[model samples]
Target: MGWHIEGTYFENCNCDSICPCATSGLTAPADYERCQVELAFHVDTGEINGIQVGGLTVCLIGDAPQQMSDGGWKIGVLMDAAASPEQAEALGSVFGGQAGGPMAGLAPLIGEMVGMESHEINYSDDGRRHRIQVGDAVNVDVEDFVSPLDPTELGVRVSGIGFPADTLAAGTGTTATVDVFGMEWDNAGKNSFSAPFAWAA
Candidate 1:
């Protein structure tokens, strides 16, 4: 079987303006002794093993020690509640790195599986601004750093970081409170990045 998905992705973490994980290619230690972050996604169009999976949303939350590449990460997955059992399961395989797609590239960095949860995901888009809300569990929003010379463009565009897209827009958390899997953190004013994403296998 084969699978493919394409959409948008944005992430925020407990780093400064620019996340070291992005700049150092996952090799630098987090700004703090530990790391806390969330990767939220919205699938505009996709399928898994022939199952339609468009309009679904998912978020990956993690707590890692030092460099992200050092592994030993405690992570959790959150899927939208609207999905059927089959859809949910299919998403789990893709996100859990079982379907052997781009996500597989990140499997080695996971040390502990915190499991998955289902909820009504709310994803909002406003130009370079983005927001993710799931009841009280997650409340986060971010906006890209606009180029000083070109207010309509991102201040920075990074590439070759092994992320969703070859180049990503860098930003910072405006407000956030991520709580799930018994781990929580506030990413307010922390590092954030966003980009349009497309993946296949």
Candidate 2:
């Protein structure tokens, strides 16, 4: 009944430079006067209800009205197709906020559960860049930004209130797309970042 997970996560949103959601738990108006984003997680090591979830990938695509802190989010979830039925269910529980963990903290913000499904999720990280594809529903490619002060260093470190307290600001090399579960958006050259995250409950 207990669980713990640690991994790397990245997201692309319509917000400019810095997303307000990271700092204010509320997103500022973007191109659509709303916040649309796609988040992907690669689990390096994890377990839930005795189920091993290492090496699995999960994605969330959603949109929020006005401000994220105001809630009213319409979201959908996608799990890796390679996951077994049990693993899928366990993932659903945790992501659905039923199992209680880091995700539980954001459950209240969700206004609608569009759906959940298993898909062919491909995730790759090569030190500098992160790429993800969920069947034909989503595609994202991003890379860490070179520090202005230190070109050799990738990304500028920052602290915020989210799954990962510490994060590296990143930039998208290509446009990201999401077309699934009635949520459609194209976030090209927008805000993005990545961080190592750990959660337990």
Candidate 3:
């Protein structure tokens, strides 16, 4: 049976504005010799194997080498604690790249999956502002840039990032941190992106 999900997603990374990985399709090297990122999403409406997973939040914590296309990333998953056992299992299959979807394309880039854990995930989306917090362990928030002439419109958007979405609105990370899986980062004032996404497998 196939699963389908549609939601809003955002991510923050320790990269300068206009990250090469995001813009160059992961063919370029990251700044500061490394890449640390947190990808967050809120499932507005979704189902995995008939299990409803709407209103749940998930985050992917990852660390990659300079050249992301070189293909070696240490990653971990944090799921909303509100999920039931069966829901968690189903959601994991979709995100773990076992169920066949956009995420499956990223499976080969993973060098190690640290683990998956349930946590009290707090995610909020208000237009250009997006935020995610998991207790005190993880925090990431981004604010999309807007045009000076018209503050309501996004300033930058690009296609082909390989994220489930066709185009992404670029932003700046106001706060980004992670303290899990023996990994820690204090990456603030970096690159960020937000977009509406739909995935099916």
Clashing pairs in 1: none
Query: Clashing residue pairs in candidate 2, if any?
Result: none
Ranking of models by lDDT: 3, 1, 2
C-alpha TM-score for every candidate: 0.95, 0.92, 0.95
Please list the residue runs of candidate 2 whose C-alpha ends up more than 4 Å from where it truly belongs after superposition. 27-32
Clashing pairs in 3: none
Task: Let me know the TM-score candidate 3 reaches against the reference structure.
Answer: 0.95
Worst 10 residues of 2 by lDDT: 23-32
Q: Tell me how far the alpha carbon of residue 172 in candidate 2 is from the true structure, in angstroms, after superposition.
A: 3.0
RMSD of 1: 1.3
lDDT of each residue in 53-162, candidate 3, tens digit only: 99898899999999998888999999999999998898888888999998898899999999998999999999789999998879888898886887657567878777
Q: Please provide, for model 1 over 1-201, each residue's C-alpha lDDT reduced to its tens digit, 9 standing for 90 to 100.
A: 888898899999988878887778787778988889999989889999999999999999989997788899998999999899999999999888999877898899899999899999999766589999987789999988877799656467777777778888888889978888999889899989898888888
The whole-model lDDT of each prediction reads 0.88, 0.81, 0.88
